[model samples]
Target: MDWDKLRIFHAVADAGSLTHAGESLHLSQSAVSRQIRALEESLNTTLFRRHARGLILTEQGELLFEATRTMTKRLDATAARIRDSEDEVFGELRVTTTLGFGTLWLLPRLPRLFALYPNLKIDLMLEEKLLDLPMREADVAIRMKEPSQAELIRRRLMDVRICFYANADYVARNGMPETAEALADHRLITQSPSSPQVRAGLEFSQPFVAAANHSAMTVNTYFGILQGVIHGIGIGSLPDYVTADFPDLVRVLPDVQSATIPVYLAYVEELRHSKRVCAFRDFVLEEIQSFRRRALPEAPETGHAMTP
Candidate 1:
Protein backbone atom coordinates (compact mmCIF):
# COMPACT_ATOMS: atom_id res chain seq x y z
CA MET A 1 0.00 0.00 0.00
CA ASP A 2 1.31 3.48 -0.94
CA TRP A 3 0.96 5.95 1.95
CA ASP A 4 1.14 8.93 -0.37
CA LYS A 5 -1.59 7.60 -2.62
CA LEU A 6 -3.78 6.78 0.36
CA ARG A 7 -3.26 10.29 1.73
CA ILE A 8 -4.19 11.85 -1.59
CA PHE A 9 -7.25 9.63 -1.91
CA HIS A 10 -8.37 10.63 1.58
CA ALA A 11 -8.05 14.31 0.77
CA VAL A 12 -9.89 13.98 -2.55
CA ALA A 13 -12.64 11.87 -1.01
CA ASP A 14 -13.01 14.36 1.85
CA ALA A 15 -13.21 17.36 -0.46
CA GLY A 16 -15.34 15.51 -3.03
CA SER A 17 -13.54 17.37 -5.85
CA LEU A 18 -10.20 16.94 -7.58
CA THR A 19 -9.50 20.69 -7.67
CA HIS A 20 -10.34 21.24 -4.05
CA ALA A 21 -8.19 18.33 -2.86
CA GLY A 22 -5.37 19.49 -5.14
CA GLU A 23 -5.55 22.97 -3.67
CA SER A 24 -5.41 21.55 -0.14
CA LEU A 25 -2.45 19.29 -0.98
CA HIS A 26 -0.74 21.90 -3.17
CA LEU A 27 -0.83 19.53 -6.20
CA SER A 28 -2.13 19.99 -9.70
CA GLN A 29 -5.62 18.59 -10.31
CA SER A 30 -4.21 16.25 -12.98
CA ALA A 31 -1.63 14.91 -10.51
CA VAL A 32 -4.38 14.26 -7.90
CA SER A 33 -6.51 12.50 -10.52
CA ARG A 34 -3.58 10.32 -11.56
CA GLN A 35 -2.92 9.35 -7.90
CA ILE A 36 -6.58 8.48 -7.37
CA ARG A 37 -6.58 6.34 -10.54
CA ALA A 38 -3.39 4.58 -9.42
CA LEU A 39 -4.85 3.93 -5.96
CA GLU A 40 -8.01 2.49 -7.54
CA GLU A 41 -5.87 0.21 -9.74
CA SER A 42 -3.74 -0.86 -6.80
CA LEU A 43 -6.82 -1.76 -4.77
CA ASN A 44 -8.49 -3.36 -7.84
CA THR A 45 -11.71 -1.55 -6.93
CA THR A 46 -13.56 1.58 -7.97
CA LEU A 47 -13.16 4.09 -5.16
CA PHE A 48 -15.53 6.80 -6.27
CA ARG A 49 -18.34 7.59 -8.68
CA ARG A 50 -18.01 10.89 -10.56
CA HIS A 51 -21.24 12.83 -10.93
CA ALA A 52 -21.92 16.21 -12.54
CA ARG A 53 -22.00 17.88 -9.16
CA GLY A 54 -18.96 16.18 -7.58
CA LEU A 55 -17.48 12.83 -6.61
CA ILE A 56 -19.26 10.33 -4.34
CA LEU A 57 -17.51 7.53 -2.53
CA THR A 58 -18.20 3.95 -3.65
CA GLU A 59 -18.76 1.30 -0.93
CA GLN A 60 -15.05 0.52 -0.96
CA GLY A 61 -14.21 4.21 -0.77
CA GLU A 62 -16.60 4.67 2.12
CA LEU A 63 -14.88 1.89 4.06
CA LEU A 64 -11.45 3.34 3.27
CA PHE A 65 -12.60 6.84 4.21
CA GLU A 66 -13.81 5.70 7.63
CA ALA A 67 -10.42 4.12 8.38
CA THR A 68 -8.60 7.23 7.12
CA ARG A 69 -10.78 9.56 9.22
CA THR A 70 -9.95 7.65 12.40
CA MET A 71 -6.28 7.52 11.42
CA THR A 72 -6.22 11.27 10.78
CA LYS A 73 -7.71 12.11 14.19
CA ARG A 74 -5.32 9.78 16.03
CA LEU A 75 -2.36 11.16 14.08
CA ASP A 76 -3.45 14.71 14.87
CA ALA A 77 -3.67 13.88 18.55
CA THR A 78 -0.23 12.28 18.46
CA ALA A 79 1.21 15.34 16.72
CA ALA A 80 -0.25 17.59 19.38
CA ARG A 81 1.28 15.47 22.12
CA ILE A 82 4.65 15.51 20.40
CA ARG A 83 4.49 19.28 20.04
CA ASP A 84 4.01 19.79 23.78
CA SER A 85 7.19 20.52 25.68
CA GLU A 86 8.14 18.41 28.68
CA ASP A 87 8.03 21.41 31.02
CA GLU A 88 5.69 23.74 29.18
CA VAL A 89 1.97 22.96 29.56
CA PHE A 90 0.41 24.37 26.41
CA GLY A 91 -1.97 22.51 24.13
CA GLU A 92 -5.64 21.73 23.68
CA LEU A 93 -6.88 20.02 26.86
CA ARG A 94 -10.41 18.68 26.64
CA VAL A 95 -11.96 18.62 30.11
CA THR A 96 -15.37 17.11 30.73
CA THR A 97 -17.56 17.39 33.82
CA THR A 98 -21.16 17.69 34.83
CA LEU A 99 -22.96 20.83 33.73
CA GLY A 100 -23.53 22.05 37.29
CA PHE A 101 -19.90 21.84 38.43
CA GLY A 102 -18.54 23.17 35.16
CA THR A 103 -20.70 26.26 35.26
CA LEU A 104 -20.82 26.92 39.01
CA TRP A 105 -17.38 25.83 40.19
CA LEU A 106 -14.80 25.16 37.48
CA LEU A 107 -15.85 27.96 35.09
CA PRO A 108 -15.30 30.66 37.71
CA ARG A 109 -11.79 29.39 38.45
CA LEU A 110 -10.61 29.03 34.83
CA PRO A 111 -9.41 32.64 34.50
CA ARG A 112 -6.74 31.90 37.08
CA LEU A 113 -5.67 28.76 35.24
CA PHE A 114 -5.47 30.70 31.95
CA ALA A 115 -3.56 33.56 33.54
CA LEU A 116 -0.82 31.14 34.56
CA TYR A 117 -0.62 29.33 31.23
CA PRO A 118 -1.41 31.97 28.66
CA ASN A 119 -0.82 29.64 25.73
CA LEU A 120 -2.95 26.81 27.07
CA LYS A 121 -6.14 26.02 25.18
CA ILE A 122 -9.00 24.54 27.19
CA ASP A 123 -11.97 22.83 25.55
CA LEU A 124 -14.51 22.54 28.33
CA MET A 125 -17.17 19.87 27.71
CA LEU A 126 -19.99 20.19 30.19
CA GLU A 127 -22.44 17.30 30.13
CA GLU A 128 -23.89 14.74 32.48
CA LYS A 129 -22.90 11.84 30.24
CA LEU A 130 -19.48 10.42 30.95
CA LEU A 131 -17.08 10.74 28.01
CA ASP A 132 -14.89 7.74 27.17
CA LEU A 133 -11.49 8.87 28.44
CA PRO A 134 -9.56 5.77 27.35
CA MET A 135 -10.99 6.05 23.82
CA ARG A 136 -9.94 9.72 23.72
CA GLU A 137 -13.47 11.12 23.74
CA ALA A 138 -12.08 13.63 26.22
CA ASP A 139 -8.63 14.18 27.71
CA VAL A 140 -9.78 14.48 31.32
CA ALA A 141 -12.92 14.20 33.42
CA ILE A 142 -14.13 15.35 36.84
CA ARG A 143 -17.02 13.16 37.75
CA MET A 144 -19.37 13.39 40.72
CA LYS A 145 -19.07 9.66 41.28
CA GLU A 146 -15.95 7.56 40.97
CA PRO A 147 -15.42 6.69 37.30
CA SER A 148 -15.89 3.00 36.68
CA GLN A 149 -14.25 3.01 33.26
CA ALA A 150 -11.19 0.85 32.77
CA GLU A 151 -7.64 1.72 31.60
CA LEU A 152 -7.66 5.04 33.42
CA ILE A 153 -5.84 6.71 36.31
CA ARG A 154 -8.27 7.95 38.92
CA ARG A 155 -7.88 10.26 41.92
CA ARG A 156 -10.55 11.17 44.43
CA LEU A 157 -10.70 14.96 44.46
CA MET A 158 -13.28 15.58 47.17
CA ASP A 159 -16.65 14.66 48.58
CA VAL A 160 -19.80 16.71 48.11
CA ARG A 161 -23.32 16.52 49.53
CA ILE A 162 -26.57 18.07 48.49
CA CYS A 163 -28.44 20.39 50.84
CA PHE A 164 -31.22 22.94 50.80
CA TYR A 165 -30.53 26.60 50.07
CA ALA A 166 -32.43 29.79 49.30
CA ASN A 167 -31.47 33.41 48.66
CA ALA A 168 -31.32 35.67 51.74
CA ASP A 169 -34.01 37.90 50.29
CA TYR A 170 -36.29 34.92 49.75
CA VAL A 171 -35.70 33.75 53.29
CA ALA A 172 -36.40 37.23 54.59
CA ARG A 173 -39.68 37.45 52.70
CA ASN A 174 -40.92 33.92 53.44
CA GLY A 175 -38.92 33.06 56.56
CA MET A 176 -36.70 30.00 56.84
CA PRO A 177 -37.82 26.45 57.59
CA GLU A 178 -35.93 24.96 60.49
CA THR A 179 -37.59 21.59 60.18
CA ALA A 180 -38.43 19.32 57.26
CA GLU A 181 -42.14 19.43 58.15
CA ALA A 182 -42.20 23.24 57.88
CA LEU A 183 -41.11 23.04 54.20
CA ALA A 184 -44.74 22.45 53.20
CA ASP A 185 -45.48 26.18 53.27
CA HIS A 186 -42.72 27.30 50.84
CA ARG A 187 -42.26 26.81 47.10
CA LEU A 188 -39.64 24.16 46.23
CA ILE A 189 -37.13 24.31 43.42
CA THR A 190 -35.10 21.26 42.49
CA GLN A 191 -33.76 19.04 39.76
CA SER A 192 -36.33 16.66 38.32
CA PRO A 193 -35.89 13.08 39.47
CA SER A 194 -35.91 11.98 35.84
CA SER A 195 -32.96 14.23 35.04
CA PRO A 196 -29.42 12.86 35.01
CA GLN A 197 -27.86 13.59 38.40
CA VAL A 198 -26.00 11.86 41.17
CA ARG A 199 -28.02 9.54 43.39
CA ALA A 200 -27.17 11.59 46.47
CA GLY A 201 -28.67 14.73 44.95
CA LEU A 202 -31.83 12.91 43.96
CA GLU A 203 -32.19 11.43 47.41
CA PHE A 204 -31.84 14.83 49.10
CA SER A 205 -34.33 16.47 46.76
CA GLN A 206 -37.01 13.77 47.00
CA PRO A 207 -38.03 14.60 50.55
CA PHE A 208 -38.46 18.27 49.65
CA VAL A 209 -40.65 17.39 46.69
CA ALA A 210 -42.89 15.27 48.88
CA ALA A 211 -43.11 17.98 51.55
CA ALA A 212 -43.79 21.06 49.40
CA ASN A 213 -47.45 21.98 49.54
CA HIS A 214 -47.04 25.14 47.47
CA SER A 215 -46.05 25.37 43.82
CA ALA A 216 -42.80 23.69 42.72
CA MET A 217 -40.40 24.09 39.86
CA THR A 218 -38.27 21.23 38.56
CA VAL A 219 -35.24 21.94 36.36
CA ASN A 220 -33.10 19.42 34.54
CA THR A 221 -29.78 20.93 35.62
CA TYR A 222 -28.43 22.27 38.89
CA PHE A 223 -27.49 25.49 37.11
CA GLY A 224 -31.14 26.16 36.54
CA ILE A 225 -31.96 25.41 40.15
CA LEU A 226 -29.16 27.74 41.26
CA GLN A 227 -30.53 30.49 39.09
CA GLY A 228 -33.98 29.99 40.57
CA VAL A 229 -32.58 30.26 44.07
CA ILE A 230 -30.60 33.38 43.16
CA HIS A 231 -33.73 35.10 41.94
CA GLY A 232 -35.60 34.28 45.15
CA ILE A 233 -37.77 31.60 43.61
CA GLY A 234 -37.69 29.11 46.48
CA ILE A 235 -35.59 26.72 48.46
CA GLY A 236 -33.48 24.51 46.19
CA SER A 237 -31.42 21.37 46.60
CA LEU A 238 -27.86 22.25 45.62
CA PRO A 239 -24.42 20.78 46.10
CA ASP A 240 -22.42 22.16 48.98
CA TYR A 241 -19.63 23.30 46.63
CA VAL A 242 -21.84 26.08 45.32
CA THR A 243 -21.73 27.93 48.65
CA ALA A 244 -18.20 29.18 48.03
CA ASP A 245 -19.28 30.88 44.80
CA PHE A 246 -22.70 32.08 46.01
CA PRO A 247 -22.21 33.56 49.47
CA ASP A 248 -25.67 35.14 49.57
CA LEU A 249 -27.49 31.82 49.48
CA VAL A 250 -28.63 30.78 52.96
CA ARG A 251 -28.42 27.14 53.92
CA VAL A 252 -31.78 25.94 55.15
CA LEU A 253 -32.44 22.82 57.24
CA PRO A 254 -28.88 22.60 58.46
CA ASP A 255 -29.30 19.05 59.74
CA VAL A 256 -30.81 17.68 56.55
CA GLN A 257 -28.24 16.67 53.89
CA SER A 258 -27.47 13.93 51.47
CA ALA A 259 -24.85 11.24 51.93
CA THR A 260 -21.60 12.53 50.53
CA ILE A 261 -20.78 11.57 46.95
CA PRO A 262 -17.14 11.11 46.03
CA VAL A 263 -15.84 13.34 43.27
CA TYR A 264 -13.06 11.83 41.17
CA LEU A 265 -10.61 13.16 38.59
CA ALA A 266 -9.59 10.72 35.91
CA TYR A 267 -7.62 10.51 32.67
CA VAL A 268 -6.29 7.74 30.46
CA GLU A 269 -3.24 5.96 31.85
CA GLU A 270 -1.39 6.87 28.64
CA LEU A 271 -1.71 10.54 29.59
CA ARG A 272 -0.15 10.08 33.04
CA HIS A 273 3.08 11.73 31.95
CA SER A 274 1.56 14.28 29.57
CA LYS A 275 2.47 17.81 30.64
CA ARG A 276 -0.95 19.28 29.88
CA VAL A 277 -2.78 16.61 31.85
CA CYS A 278 -0.45 16.86 34.84
CA ALA A 279 -0.76 20.64 34.91
CA PHE A 280 -4.56 20.48 34.81
CA ARG A 281 -4.71 17.86 37.53
CA ASP A 282 -2.41 19.85 39.82
CA PHE A 283 -4.32 23.06 39.20
CA VAL A 284 -7.64 21.41 40.02
CA LEU A 285 -6.28 19.89 43.24
CA GLU A 286 -4.86 23.25 44.32
CA GLU A 287 -8.09 25.08 43.52
CA ILE A 288 -10.19 22.53 45.38
CA GLN A 289 -7.98 22.99 48.42
CA SER A 290 -8.48 26.72 48.21
CA PHE A 291 -12.21 26.29 47.79
CA ARG A 292 -12.35 24.08 50.84
CA ARG A 293 -10.54 26.68 52.89
CA ARG A 294 -12.87 29.44 51.77
CA ALA A 295 -15.95 27.36 52.49
CA LEU A 296 -14.99 26.81 56.14
CA PRO A 297 -17.02 29.75 57.34
CA GLU A 298 -20.14 31.50 56.21
CA ALA A 299 -20.11 35.10 55.03
CA PRO A 300 -20.61 37.40 58.02
CA GLU A 301 -24.11 38.48 56.97
CA THR A 302 -25.48 35.22 55.51
CA GLY A 303 -25.98 33.69 59.04
CA HIS A 304 -25.57 30.13 57.73
CA ALA A 305 -22.62 27.76 57.55
CA MET A 306 -21.12 27.05 54.12
CA THR A 307 -21.06 23.51 52.77
CA PRO A 308 -18.03 21.54 53.77
Candidate 2:
Protein backbone atom coordinates (compact mmCIF):
# COMPACT_ATOMS: atom_id res chain seq x y z
CA MET A 1 0.00 0.00 0.00
CA ASP A 2 2.83 2.39 0.90
CA TRP A 3 4.94 2.61 -2.27
CA ASP A 4 7.95 4.14 -0.53
CA LYS A 5 8.04 1.48 2.18
CA LEU A 6 7.51 -1.25 -0.42
CA ARG A 7 10.44 0.15 -2.44
CA ILE A 8 12.67 0.21 0.66
CA PHE A 9 11.62 -3.31 1.62
CA HIS A 10 12.34 -4.59 -1.89
CA ALA A 11 15.79 -3.02 -1.85
CA VAL A 12 16.59 -4.48 1.58
CA ALA A 13 15.35 -7.92 0.57
CA ASP A 14 17.31 -7.74 -2.68
CA ALA A 15 20.54 -6.66 -0.99
CA GLY A 16 20.01 -8.76 2.17
CA SER A 17 21.74 -6.03 4.17
CA LEU A 18 20.17 -2.86 5.50
CA THR A 19 23.44 -0.96 5.17
CA HIS A 20 23.94 -2.03 1.56
CA ALA A 21 20.34 -1.29 0.61
CA GLY A 22 20.54 2.09 2.34
CA GLU A 23 23.71 2.94 0.42
CA SER A 24 22.04 1.97 -2.86
CA LEU A 25 18.93 4.05 -2.09
CA HIS A 26 21.02 6.97 -0.77
CA LEU A 27 19.26 6.75 2.57
CA SER A 28 20.52 6.23 6.13
CA GLN A 29 20.40 2.71 7.53
CA SER A 30 18.08 3.86 10.35
CA ALA A 31 15.71 5.42 7.80
CA VAL A 32 15.58 2.17 5.78
CA SER A 33 15.10 0.07 8.90
CA ARG A 34 12.27 2.33 10.10
CA GLN A 35 10.48 1.95 6.72
CA ILE A 36 10.83 -1.84 6.82
CA ARG A 37 9.50 -1.90 10.40
CA ALA A 38 6.56 0.28 9.43
CA LEU A 39 5.84 -1.97 6.44
CA GLU A 40 5.93 -5.07 8.63
CA GLU A 41 3.71 -3.38 11.23
CA SER A 42 1.20 -2.36 8.56
CA LEU A 43 1.17 -5.90 7.18
CA ASN A 44 0.80 -7.33 10.71
CA THR A 45 3.64 -9.84 10.22
CA THR A 46 7.39 -10.20 10.47
CA LEU A 47 9.13 -9.09 7.25
CA PHE A 48 12.72 -9.94 8.08
CA ARG A 49 14.74 -11.88 10.63
CA ARG A 50 17.73 -9.74 11.58
CA HIS A 51 21.05 -11.48 12.32
CA ALA A 52 24.52 -10.22 13.02
CA ARG A 53 25.58 -11.37 9.59
CA GLY A 54 22.69 -9.78 7.58
CA LEU A 55 18.93 -9.72 6.98
CA ILE A 56 16.92 -12.67 5.74
CA LEU A 57 13.41 -12.26 4.38
CA THR A 58 10.72 -14.16 6.24
CA GLU A 59 7.96 -16.02 4.33
CA GLN A 60 5.72 -12.93 4.36
CA GLY A 61 8.64 -10.78 3.24
CA GLU A 62 9.33 -13.16 0.39
CA LEU A 63 5.73 -12.88 -0.83
CA LEU A 64 5.84 -9.08 -0.61
CA PHE A 65 9.21 -8.98 -2.30
CA GLU A 66 7.95 -11.08 -5.20
CA ALA A 67 5.06 -8.66 -5.65
CA THR A 68 7.42 -5.68 -5.55
CA ARG A 69 9.78 -7.36 -8.01
CA THR A 70 6.95 -7.77 -10.50
CA MET A 71 5.97 -4.17 -9.94
CA THR A 72 9.56 -3.01 -10.56
CA LYS A 73 9.85 -4.94 -13.81
CA ARG A 74 6.53 -3.58 -15.04
CA LEU A 75 7.54 0.00 -14.22
CA ASP A 76 10.87 -0.49 -15.97
CA ALA A 77 9.09 -1.88 -18.99
CA THR A 78 6.83 1.17 -19.05
CA ALA A 79 9.82 3.50 -18.89
CA ALA A 80 11.53 1.55 -21.68
CA ARG A 81 8.42 1.76 -23.82
CA ILE A 82 8.25 5.51 -23.33
CA ARG A 83 11.90 5.84 -24.24
CA ASP A 84 11.39 3.58 -27.25
CA SER A 85 8.91 6.09 -28.67
CA GLU A 86 11.86 8.43 -29.13
CA ASP A 87 14.00 8.28 -32.29
CA GLU A 88 17.06 6.82 -30.52
CA VAL A 89 17.87 3.17 -29.79
CA PHE A 90 20.09 3.66 -26.74
CA GLY A 91 19.16 1.43 -23.82
CA GLU A 92 20.11 -2.01 -22.50
CA LEU A 93 18.67 -4.74 -24.66
CA ARG A 94 19.07 -8.17 -23.05
CA VAL A 95 19.31 -10.81 -25.77
CA THR A 96 19.41 -14.53 -25.10
CA THR A 97 20.53 -17.35 -27.38
CA THR A 98 22.29 -20.69 -27.34
CA LEU A 99 26.00 -20.68 -26.44
CA GLY A 100 27.14 -21.98 -29.85
CA PHE A 101 25.13 -19.56 -31.98
CA GLY A 102 25.83 -16.63 -29.71
CA THR A 103 29.60 -17.14 -29.76
CA LEU A 104 30.00 -18.44 -33.31
CA TRP A 105 27.31 -16.62 -35.30
CA LEU A 106 26.01 -13.58 -33.40
CA LEU A 107 29.10 -12.20 -31.70
CA PRO A 108 31.11 -12.03 -34.90
CA ARG A 109 28.38 -9.98 -36.64
CA LEU A 110 27.58 -7.63 -33.71
CA PRO A 111 30.14 -5.05 -34.83
CA ARG A 112 27.90 -4.06 -37.71
CA LEU A 113 25.04 -3.49 -35.26
CA PHE A 114 27.26 -1.34 -33.04
CA ALA A 115 28.34 0.64 -36.07
CA LEU A 116 24.70 1.29 -36.93
CA TYR A 117 23.56 2.20 -33.40
CA PRO A 118 26.63 3.37 -31.54
CA ASN A 119 24.66 4.17 -28.37
CA LEU A 120 22.89 0.81 -28.11
CA LYS A 121 23.84 -1.39 -25.16
CA ILE A 122 23.70 -5.14 -25.70
CA ASP A 123 23.53 -7.65 -22.86
CA LEU A 124 24.05 -10.99 -24.56
CA MET A 125 23.01 -13.85 -22.28
CA LEU A 126 24.45 -17.03 -23.80
CA GLU A 127 23.23 -20.31 -22.30
CA GLU A 128 21.14 -23.37 -23.17
CA LYS A 129 18.49 -22.58 -20.55
CA LEU A 130 15.43 -20.99 -22.13
CA LEU A 131 14.66 -17.71 -20.36
CA ASP A 132 11.11 -16.54 -19.74
CA LEU A 133 10.31 -13.92 -22.38
CA PRO A 134 6.94 -12.61 -21.24
CA MET A 135 8.31 -12.28 -17.72
CA ARG A 136 11.13 -10.14 -19.16
CA GLU A 137 13.98 -12.55 -18.43
CA ALA A 138 15.42 -11.33 -21.72
CA ASP A 139 14.44 -8.76 -24.35
CA VAL A 140 14.91 -11.13 -27.30
CA ALA A 141 15.90 -14.73 -27.93
CA ILE A 142 17.43 -16.58 -30.89
CA ARG A 143 16.63 -20.21 -30.27
CA MET A 144 17.11 -23.58 -32.00
CA LYS A 145 13.41 -24.31 -32.14
CA GLU A 146 10.05 -22.55 -32.17
CA PRO A 147 9.22 -21.27 -28.68
CA SER A 148 6.29 -23.07 -27.10
CA GLN A 149 5.40 -20.06 -24.96
CA ALA A 150 2.28 -18.22 -26.03
CA GLU A 151 1.89 -14.43 -26.55
CA LEU A 152 5.38 -14.14 -28.03
CA ILE A 153 6.16 -12.44 -31.33
CA ARG A 154 8.50 -14.97 -32.96
CA ARG A 155 10.25 -15.06 -36.35
CA ARG A 156 12.03 -18.03 -37.83
CA LEU A 157 15.53 -16.81 -38.67
CA MET A 158 17.05 -19.83 -40.41
CA ASP A 159 17.49 -23.59 -40.27
CA VAL A 160 20.80 -25.01 -39.00
CA ARG A 161 22.11 -28.50 -39.70
CA ILE A 162 24.33 -30.12 -37.09
CA CYS A 163 26.97 -32.40 -38.57
CA PHE A 164 30.43 -33.85 -38.04
CA TYR A 165 33.49 -31.64 -38.48
CA ALA A 166 37.21 -32.08 -37.91
CA ASN A 167 40.37 -30.03 -38.18
CA ALA A 168 41.91 -30.20 -41.64
CA ASP A 169 45.10 -31.67 -40.20
CA TYR A 170 43.13 -34.32 -38.34
CA VAL A 171 41.43 -35.34 -41.54
CA ALA A 172 44.75 -35.23 -43.35
CA ARG A 173 46.25 -37.59 -40.81
CA ASN A 174 43.31 -40.00 -40.32
CA GLY A 175 41.44 -39.45 -43.62
CA MET A 176 37.71 -38.75 -43.87
CA PRO A 177 35.13 -41.18 -42.58
CA GLU A 178 33.13 -42.20 -45.67
CA THR A 179 30.66 -44.41 -43.82
CA ALA A 180 29.16 -44.76 -40.34
CA GLU A 181 31.40 -47.83 -39.89
CA ALA A 182 34.44 -45.75 -40.82
CA LEU A 183 33.81 -43.47 -37.78
CA ALA A 184 35.09 -46.36 -35.63
CA ASP A 185 38.67 -45.51 -36.64
CA HIS A 186 38.61 -41.85 -35.38
CA ARG A 187 38.20 -40.24 -31.99
CA LEU A 188 35.09 -38.04 -31.47
CA ILE A 189 34.86 -34.66 -29.73
CA THR A 190 31.29 -33.46 -29.38
CA GLN A 191 28.66 -31.94 -27.07
CA SER A 192 28.05 -34.14 -24.06
CA PRO A 193 25.21 -36.54 -24.81
CA SER A 194 23.56 -35.36 -21.57
CA SER A 195 23.93 -31.66 -22.35
CA PRO A 196 20.90 -29.66 -23.37
CA GLN A 197 20.99 -29.09 -27.14
CA VAL A 198 18.53 -29.19 -30.00
CA ARG A 199 16.81 -32.52 -30.53
CA ALA A 200 18.02 -32.72 -34.12
CA GLY A 201 21.64 -32.34 -33.02
CA LEU A 202 21.31 -35.00 -30.31
CA GLU A 203 19.63 -37.46 -32.69
CA PHE A 204 22.21 -36.86 -35.42
CA SER A 205 25.11 -37.53 -33.03
CA GLN A 206 23.69 -40.71 -31.43
CA PRO A 207 24.85 -43.12 -34.14
CA PHE A 208 28.28 -41.43 -34.24
CA VAL A 209 28.58 -41.90 -30.45
CA ALA A 210 28.00 -45.64 -30.89
CA ALA A 211 30.29 -45.85 -33.92
CA ALA A 212 33.39 -43.91 -32.79
CA ASN A 213 36.09 -46.35 -31.68
CA HIS A 214 37.22 -44.04 -28.88
CA SER A 215 34.82 -42.78 -26.26
CA ALA A 216 33.94 -39.15 -27.13
CA MET A 217 35.31 -36.17 -25.26
CA THR A 218 32.04 -34.35 -24.47
CA VAL A 219 32.07 -30.60 -23.96
CA ASN A 220 28.97 -28.83 -22.67
CA THR A 221 29.20 -26.01 -25.20
CA TYR A 222 29.65 -26.06 -28.98
CA PHE A 223 32.40 -23.43 -28.70
CA GLY A 224 34.37 -25.84 -26.50
CA ILE A 225 33.82 -28.68 -28.95
CA LEU A 226 34.86 -26.40 -31.82
CA GLN A 227 38.05 -25.53 -29.99
CA GLY A 228 38.74 -29.19 -29.40
CA VAL A 229 38.14 -29.95 -33.09
CA ILE A 230 40.29 -26.98 -34.16
CA HIS A 231 43.22 -28.17 -32.10
CA GLY A 232 43.16 -31.61 -33.76
CA ILE A 233 41.74 -33.34 -30.71
CA GLY A 234 39.18 -35.26 -32.76
CA ILE A 235 36.24 -35.00 -35.12
CA GLY A 236 33.32 -33.02 -33.60
CA SER A 237 29.62 -32.59 -34.13
CA LEU A 238 28.79 -28.96 -34.86
CA PRO A 239 26.36 -26.69 -36.62
CA ASP A 240 26.80 -26.36 -40.40
CA TYR A 241 26.82 -22.56 -40.06
CA VAL A 242 30.26 -22.84 -38.43
CA THR A 243 31.98 -23.76 -41.69
CA ALA A 244 31.26 -20.33 -43.21
CA ASP A 245 33.35 -18.66 -40.49
CA PHE A 246 35.80 -21.45 -39.62
CA PRO A 247 37.43 -22.31 -42.96
CA ASP A 248 40.01 -24.70 -41.50
CA LEU A 249 37.34 -27.04 -40.12
CA VAL A 250 36.19 -29.51 -42.74
CA ARG A 251 32.87 -31.35 -42.80
CA VAL A 252 33.53 -34.95 -41.75
CA LEU A 253 30.82 -36.69 -43.81
CA PRO A 254 29.55 -34.45 -46.58
CA ASP A 255 26.65 -36.76 -47.37
CA VAL A 256 25.46 -37.04 -43.78
CA GLN A 257 23.79 -34.20 -41.75
CA SER A 258 21.16 -33.66 -39.12
CA ALA A 259 17.54 -32.89 -39.79
CA THR A 260 17.06 -29.13 -40.19
CA ILE A 261 16.92 -27.33 -36.83
CA PRO A 262 14.73 -24.26 -37.10
CA VAL A 263 16.13 -21.09 -35.55
CA TYR A 264 13.63 -18.58 -34.12
CA LEU A 265 14.04 -15.01 -32.92
CA ALA A 266 11.47 -14.04 -30.30
CA TYR A 267 10.48 -11.37 -27.82
CA VAL A 268 7.58 -10.48 -25.59
CA GLU A 269 4.55 -8.91 -27.25
CA GLU A 270 5.17 -5.87 -25.04
CA LEU A 271 8.39 -5.08 -26.94
CA ARG A 272 6.81 -5.17 -30.40
CA HIS A 273 7.10 -1.38 -30.63
CA SER A 274 10.46 -0.97 -28.86
CA LYS A 275 13.00 0.63 -31.16
CA ARG A 276 15.81 -1.46 -29.62
CA VAL A 277 13.94 -4.65 -30.40
CA CYS A 278 13.22 -3.48 -33.95
CA ALA A 279 16.86 -2.55 -34.49
CA PHE A 280 18.05 -5.94 -33.18
CA ARG A 281 15.47 -7.88 -35.22
CA ASP A 282 16.38 -6.11 -38.44
CA PHE A 283 20.08 -6.45 -37.75
CA VAL A 284 19.75 -10.20 -37.21
CA LEU A 285 17.67 -10.56 -40.39
CA GLU A 286 20.19 -8.65 -42.49
CA GLU A 287 23.08 -10.62 -41.05
CA ILE A 288 21.33 -13.89 -41.75
CA GLN A 289 20.96 -12.76 -45.36
CA SER A 290 24.66 -11.89 -45.56
CA PHE A 291 25.53 -15.24 -44.01
CA ARG A 292 23.36 -17.00 -46.59
CA ARG A 293 25.09 -15.17 -49.42
CA ARG A 294 28.49 -16.21 -48.11
CA ALA A 295 27.41 -19.79 -47.43
CA LEU A 296 25.78 -20.21 -50.86
CA PRO A 297 27.29 -17.91 -53.47
CA GLU A 298 25.81 -19.86 -56.40
CA ALA A 299 22.22 -20.02 -55.12
CA PRO A 300 19.86 -17.50 -56.66
CA GLU A 301 19.61 -14.44 -54.41
CA THR A 302 16.10 -14.93 -53.16
CA GLY A 303 16.19 -12.53 -50.23
CA HIS A 304 15.36 -13.63 -46.69
CA ALA A 305 11.67 -13.89 -45.75
CA MET A 306 9.85 -13.10 -42.46
CA THR A 307 6.94 -15.12 -41.17
CA PRO A 308 4.16 -12.91 -39.77
| Candidate No. with top TM-score | 2
Superposition-based RMSD of candidate 2 using all C-alpha atoms, in angstroms: 1.9
TM-scores, all models, native as reference: 0.82, 0.95
Error (Å) of candidate 2 at residue 233 is 0.6
Candidate 1, position 167, lDDT:
93
Q: lDDT per residue, candidate 1, 17-51, as tens digits?
A: 99999999999999999999999999999999999
Using alpha carbons, what is the TM-score of model 2?
A: 0.95
Model 1 shows how many backbone clashes?
Answer: 0
Expressed as tens digits, the lDDT of each residue in 122-201 for candidate 2 is 99999999999888888899998889987988888887888899988998888988987888788887788888898888
Q: Which pairs of residues clash in candidate 1, taking residues 3 or more apart in a chain or in different chains?
A: none
Which residue pairs in model 2 clash with each other?
none
